[model samples]
Target chain A: MELLSNLALGFGVASSLTNLGFCLIGVLLGTLIGVLPGIGATATIAMLLPITFQLEPVSSLIMLAGIYYGAQYGGSTTAILINMPGESSSAVTAIDGYQMARQGRAGTALATAALGSFFAGSVATFLVALFAPPLTAVALKFGAAEYFSLMVMGLVMSVALAHGSVLKALAMVVLGLLLGMVGTDVYTGAPRFTMGITQFADGLNFVAVAVGVFGIAEILRNLENEHDRQVMTKNISRLFPNRDEFRQMVAPILRGTGIGSVLGILPGGGAILASFASYTVEKKLSKHPEEFGKGALAGVAGPESANNAGAQTSFIPLLTLGIPANPVMALMIGAMIIQGIVPGPNVVSEQPELFWGIIASMWIGNLMLVVLNLPLIGLWVKLLTVPYYVLFPIIMAMCSIGVYSVNSNTYDLFAVAGFGLLGYVLSKLRCEPAPLLLGFVLGPLLEENLRRAMILSRGDPTTFVTRPISATLLVLSLAILVLVFLPQIRKRRDEVFTESDA
Target chain B: MSTKPKDGTDIAAGLLFMAIAGFFAWQGLGLDMGTSTRMGPGYFPMVLSGLLFILGAVILFKAFGRPDDEPMGRIAWRGILFILPAPIFFGLTVRGLGFVPALFVTTLIASQASLRMRPLAALVLSVVVTIMSTLIFSYGLGLPFRRFGPWLPL
Candidate 1:
């Protein structure tokens, strides 16, 4: 009864003319960026963050959330149309999606991806509505120690999930943690890495790092293969899936939802991991796993569903606990902060309308994406023909303008360029930037919590181990770390990592 | 011995990272990190430097152990030139040229990195982009765009 009433209030807020318009704009831009190879939702959102400063809080969040999930939809389009994936989450979809495109079944493949994403999004939104209040109540019990442990677990899992060598990933994670220490120390009002520079006082901006690593590095990568034009021609077949195709996909969709829902609860286990795990599970379950690379509809359906589901559910941690699971969620947290809304347990009770409205808007946004994308596929395909030479310069200019508008700081422009070079080098070295981002966001939070926990317990180290929740999380993280390093797991790790190539 | 690209790249990256870590650690040593009671200023950075040094050492060790497997191609100087010179250009033009001209020129140079674009097409596209961006950012959004000098026409 309470959930229903809250949802009603949410719909009332979400259906406002202004909010709806922003949501539409967000999904539209999200899909466009998603369709463009080498750009991810994080980069797109970061680049657009400055534009949102003037928007109403609800409108900004709604739009930002729309971009996050809409990219899931748009990302699948590129994966299906071109062999390239705009985001890591869509890599699994590219396996069978590109193959289906080759086989002239691109229409059906796209339809399944769209429908599956919509269904998964609806289900996840329903789960959020049903569980958010209770979850927030539970989250309220978390102390500083518990949060530290939880962040530690998240960091470990991120390292484990990274595709390359664990050592390299760990190094990157530590590097990220170090980079995160650049700003002022929050607990003590002392500057740590500022080097007497005023700009460093605020620390490295997540938006700058995100844009540099994902957006600029991606442009560099695109430039490398500028001569190789992607072939986007595909014969449009049946838009809707046939009964046979439906039968094959239903089980995978269910499995994907299950995987995605669970993974989404874990910090750092958003769309990327959900899609990757879903694809792996589907392939492992298939009798003819070889067909996975040859355009299995299940390959497209499962991962696409999981990706959308994960994208939606990742909001749970952000709204309920005030901890962002990924960079996109971090930006959302930044938005909420800008609005002067303290996220966490109080959000649900104090701002039920904002919480539920955002949830409801997600469903509306998903429906909008499906309707908008189906007919617009033809137009999006036309976008691919836009020469990279023309497109990239525009993107770079937008990035510059956006960064400048944020604080009117020319220093940040140089920062972006510096980070761009760093990002390119990191990419060349096969180091994943996402972990670094996760570390950067979580680092301050973790340090703050660590100090708080220590102060609360009078510098007692037992605080972490004595807290049941924290202990459990620490144990779980340690177990995962151990498992990842196991000889057997190491051998199979390559298989799981290289599955992205499919 | 066949030189593997991965091995060589890893070693180079490891060395570079190690050097960076070393420099940071050295810099950190100059800071007065407060104690736990005083809440020293250098506490966080010093800890970070230590961790970075350890990680750098691990990377260096890993690089040394790996054998080069393939030959690496020559560095793409064109791509480097296109991207590497951007910061210098931005720094020079940002204040005097203002945001619009600075952004336009920087983007134009960056676009030249794309091997696919013919010089003529790149130039035309750069102009179009500059105009569109100018209109959208400067005029539509009301972001402050600098006008020309006192003697210059609008």
Candidate 2:
């Protein structure tokens, strides 16, 4: 009954005209970015975050969440219609989904993906509601030491999940933390790394860094080869799947949702991992394993379901602990801070409407994607034909406006250019940017917690190990680091990533 | 073999990391680093810088004798030249030329990053993008931005 009443309250808030409208806009815009290649949800969310500053906290967050899911749905559509997946999470979907399109079953593949995502999203939303409160209770009991160790674990997890060399990723994280340390120190008003620039005393703008690293850097990467994309616009027949196809997808969708719900709660890019994991699971379990990568319906169904579930449930960490599970969640934390709500376990008690509204909006947003995207698949296919050259200019202009509008500081725009160059160089060296971005977001918080804990314990270094929760988290981080370094696991990790890349 | 082949990309990356770490460490020395119980502003950064330096050194050391070595692909020189400067141009001129003109020029500069974009197409794209952004961000969204600045004499 308590859960039911809470659900009713959430629906009551989310179903309001203004909130619903924002949700629609968010998902639509999210899908637009998702359908397009080269631009990612992280970059689009970063560029558009400033615009949301004008709305109510709940409305803005609702819209942003919608964008996240809509982008996921849109990514799958592109994967099925064209071999190019608009997002990395949908890369596995492209394997069999594109094959289906070649066989004139693009409609079936798209429908399967949409249905699977919708089902998984619904289940994940319930799971978030059922589990978030309890998790928040645990998080609320955490002391400064526990928080510090937890963040250390999160950073370690991010480094572990990052692509390519672990050493390079660790360096990126440290570099990000150093970048975060640039502004004035909180404990003492002494300036740290501002380099005598007064404008940077408040720290480098988060928006500028995000846009530069993800958006502008992406444009540069895309420009390395200006090749034409092959769009499968024809033979998209039968919007609804047949009975046999529906039956085939049901099991994979269920298994995927289960796998995704669990993994999505983990830190560091769980949605991408969830989808890949689902594909491997489905392939192993399938009787016709040979059909995989050759238009198996489960390939389209399972990963799509797993990814959507993972994407929805990834919010658990953000909502419960105020820690970002991934980069997009980091931006969400930024949005919350800008809205003047200090993100933590207290948000559940202090801002129930904001908490529940977002949970409810996920279901609503998924429903809209299923209803609106199917009929509008033709339009999205058409968008795929737009030249990449035309798109980058528009993106650049938007990035300028978006970053400038954040603080109305021209220095932020200049920072965007600087970070963009830095991001491009890092990528050229084959370094992943995700860990760096995560480190940047968590940097100040991590330092604050470490300092607070140190002061609380009278500068005793053993406090981290003395506390049970903190000790456990540190052990976990150590275990993860060891696992990643082990020659066998390292080889397997590389194989997994390389498989997804192909 | 007299000498082991090295991964050029990893070598460059390692050196870059080391240089960055050294810079931060050198700068950190200027700030006050307090004792264990009462840490200074520079303490955490100094520790991080040291960690980074070690990581860089390890990466550099491991780069040699590795079998895998893929050539670094063609660099985006054109994109770097045009795309990187677009935001800088907008930042320098947005207050002077105002939102409309600044955004217009930014788009124009950015479009040139692609060899596929013709001059006329770029011009038309810039014009349309500027107008749409002006309408949406300036008027529709009601962001307080001057359409034209005093520099334009309009």
The best candidate in terms of DockQ: 2
lDDT of 1 by residue, B1-154 (tens): 5553237666666676676667667766755665543445566556766776676677767665466543334344566678645644755566677765676677778777767768887778777877887787678767665633232244
How many Å off is the CA of A87 in candidate 2? 1.1
- Listed in order, the DockQ scores are 0.46, 0.89
Per-residue lDDT tens digits of candidate 1, residues A7-113?
Answer: 99998989999899999999999999888876788888988888787777778889999998888788888888888887778888988899998999999999999
Predicted structure with the largest TM-score when compared to the true one: 2
- Looking at candidate 2 chain A, the ten consecutive residues that score lowest on lDDT are A493-502
Q: What's the lDDT for candidate 1?
A: 0.79
lDDT by residue (tens digit), candidate 2, A332-375: 99999999999989998999999999999999999999999989
Provide TM-scores for the models. 0.94, 0.99
